[model samples]
Target: MRDLFEDTATAFALKTDSELERAYFLFKLIGNEPLVRIGTAVTNFAIKANLPVERLIRATVFDHFCGGTNEEECLVVADRMFEKGVYTILDYSVEGQQVENQLDYTFEKTLKTLDFVKEKDAIPFAVFKPTGFGRFKLYQKITEGEQLTFLEEEEWQRVVNRFDKVCKKAHDLDVSLLIDAEESYMQDAADKLVEMMMRKYNKKKAIVFNTLQTYRWDRLDYLKKLHEDAKREHFHIGMKVVRGAYMEKENDRAEEHGYPSPICPSKKATDENFNQVVTYMLDNLDLMSLFAGTHNENSSYLLMEQMQAKSIAKNDPRVWFGQLYGMSDHISYNLSDRGYNVAKYLPFGPVKDVMPYLIRRAEENTSVAGQTSRELTLLKKERKRRRI
Candidate 1:
């Protein structure tokens, strides 16, 4: 059972030789910390200077990482992945929105995606970042319990409206909606808002899913409290558990603000916390639905092991395994091949607008120990097998 994920032929079966080489090259480039840093700096400058880098970007990293510049363009990728038994979560990865119009644009885009996926099983979920729907400082203020001015209150209501619109649409259409977890300081407001949505729409099942960054030491407590509320209120709980993406930013902010870091002490501790939380969720599967968002083989194995131990079905509707589209085909394809519910986060946006997300992916690949190396190792194995 453990060896199932090692089947590279099944993993990369859809990748042509050239695409396989491109992936190997991208991972190889991402493995170098210094190179990634310089590349990010250069790319940011080019975008800021209004340089014609979109075509070049669209030809390289953008093509590899994102589906396309819009929802319609994402269908090709979504359909292809669905053909192989993996589902897609269409992610509008545009960043740094500062105006209400842009927020509405994201809201409308999310609504449009929900409409597109309403009748299509290929796309099971639609996702959006909270900061995309509203300003970061707005969430920070609410999270900090600061007083809101009258106009600020109106602005907050608009944000709430955006959340409600999407969650309600998702519920009405029976499509699951995933609200992403952001920085620790702002996540409190998002979590509360998501819990409210869950209470509203999850009476029948988990239609609104909140993300839990398991790297936070207190996430287990949060999950327990959520479970308690669900038990009392008769609402289903849906949570996507990820190791986390903002460790450095979180630690730095804690140091700057003179607060104890919310992050776990070390990777081992975080992994343990992740495992423990998943165990808790599986143990209480009756009222909670889990979206295990990870690329770690051991964590994937642990979930499979627990499912078997609990006599759960592989295609269980209450459980899912998720990975980013371009990063973890091995896990995504192999899991779906074995009949597990799986979804890939297929980020899509214009090249210039999506650079921030693309850059972060590069930086994350560089910073996360062993992730890039593992990709390289697998890509190399597949490449050698094809004598490429």
Candidate 2:
């Protein structure tokens, strides 16, 4: 086990003892409950004021989880990751801005991001959210299988056009675009849109990737269906699977309505489904490219074990790993050390506009069983090691 972990640690060449210590300390600070609560309060307050919370955010979540405040600023961090033999996936974190002009601005920013990626070869993926380009009500209609108003129907077309532009830009630039998954109710539209774009643009290479939230029971089955669909379409599938981000709200909404919850009934079920999906993807590595977006040590190690079982190479381009920037240094560094292709989801946006993202990170860290404790424990261990 030690040797395996050590081997995985080889990919992170940029982290010195000092940098690791800094990461440990940052995680430890964020894991503190009182600190998280205070940080959340201040950031939300700042959001209501429309003031830039960069300083407050930089001292809190962003300092741990993001690449930088903007694209230009992120290059230094991306360079560090490249120096360590890892890649960067730039994610634009602005969400819930609904005006049509705002959507145009968002689409332009996405194009600019793709242009930046073309100019910088180290960035492997450009990440965007569908909600960034479409109105929430329109997405709700699509997910509900309901008819849209005349205005909404037009807006929906515009949404599709925005995706066409983004996907075309990515295809032209020869970079991958990852369509991020949102809440379950809205996710169907995202999945369908990505499937459509992939069929159109992923003729010879994987230009569009869809994210699967394994915390939802339906997603594992959806993954199977996606694979079948891709086979029928005769195009490669790019998959990014995560445990999911909307647990509390998902369950609350399910209980509010009379519908059964889409999320797995228990943590055990979620873990089981996640592992099953990972194994299935590993078995079909020839036609699928996967990014396992998780921080669980067991899951990471098991992925490696499954790859070895199939006699797949450690650095197989079909398989990559990721943890959010600042959240799982150990996982990222260790996996990089093992000669695997690993990247960080490096979000960059104005702090006020990004508060929702920051708040969710706080909530997720709090809810994942023993996550805060684990982070605190690791920090203490590193501190003790330094003292010794």
Candidate 3:
């Protein structure tokens, strides 16, 4: 049971010898923490200086991690992965812009992606960050319960309009929309907006899915309360449960601002929190749908066990397992091979605009205990099997 993800043949079936070696090389580089830090700094400087690093980047980490520079290019990659029975989520992962035009562009992109998801059986979900649809400060202010000036109030209305437009389009098109969670400070506002969308769009089923970052100690309680509200209001709930990505930044901001950290105190606690949330959602599957977003093998096994115990079918539409596009082939491919619903988040954008996302991937691989090693180990096993 524990060795299900240990099958290198199924895991690396899509990777050629060259692609396998590239993955090995990238994981090796990412395993060195100091090298990753230095590389991140250098990459940021080069991108800002307008140096000719795009070609280099595109040929390496960009090609390995992202689907492509745009949706058209990404479709080629998405189609290839779909051949292996793995589904994709076309994530518009560009970062670091906060203007009205950029916000509107992201909103339009979400609408466009929802149309794509509607047409393609390979793609199951459309996703976007809250800040991608509006300015971060505006969400932060609302989260803090600050009064909005007249103009600010109007701007906030545009943000709400963007959320409504995308959610409505998804519902009309019969596509599931995933709203990603961001920093804890601004998440409250996003939560309220997502709840409104869920109430409006999830009447039939979960067309609008809100992300629950279970690394936060308070999230399980939050979900329980939200469940109460949804029960009273007669609306179905959809949630994507993830261990979270912003741990270091979250702890640092909490310390600097002299507030208690919102994060669970330890990795074990966070993992337990994640499992508990999954269990709660599974226990209440009649009223909720779950997208379990994880790379951890233990959690995956736990979900598998729970499903079997509950006598749930492997192809149940109400539950899904998700991983990032490039980072967890073993889990993604093996699960898909076994007929479970699985999707990979395939991020795509211009090189410069997407550098922040790529850099964060490298840093996360570097910081997370044993993640890079696990990737390296599997890639090495596949290479040896291929005699490469």
Better model by TM-score: candidate 2 vs candidate 3:
3
User: What tens-digit string does per-residue lDDT give for candidate 3 at 136-217?
Assistant: 9999999999999999999999999999999999898889999999999999999999999999999879899999999999
| Candidate 2 C-alpha lDDT tens digits along 83-162 | 77678888888788989998898888899999888888678888889888887778878989998889888889999999
Which rank order by lDDT, best down to worst? 3, 1, 2
Clashing pairs in 2: 7-338, 8-334, 8-337, 8-338, 9-337, 10-337, 11-336, 11-337, 64-326
lDDT of 3 at 134: 91
Global local distance difference test of model 1: 0.93
TM per model? 0.99, 0.92, 0.99
Q: Give the TM-score of candidate 2.
A: 0.92
Clashes of each: 0, 9, 0
Clashing pairs in 1: none
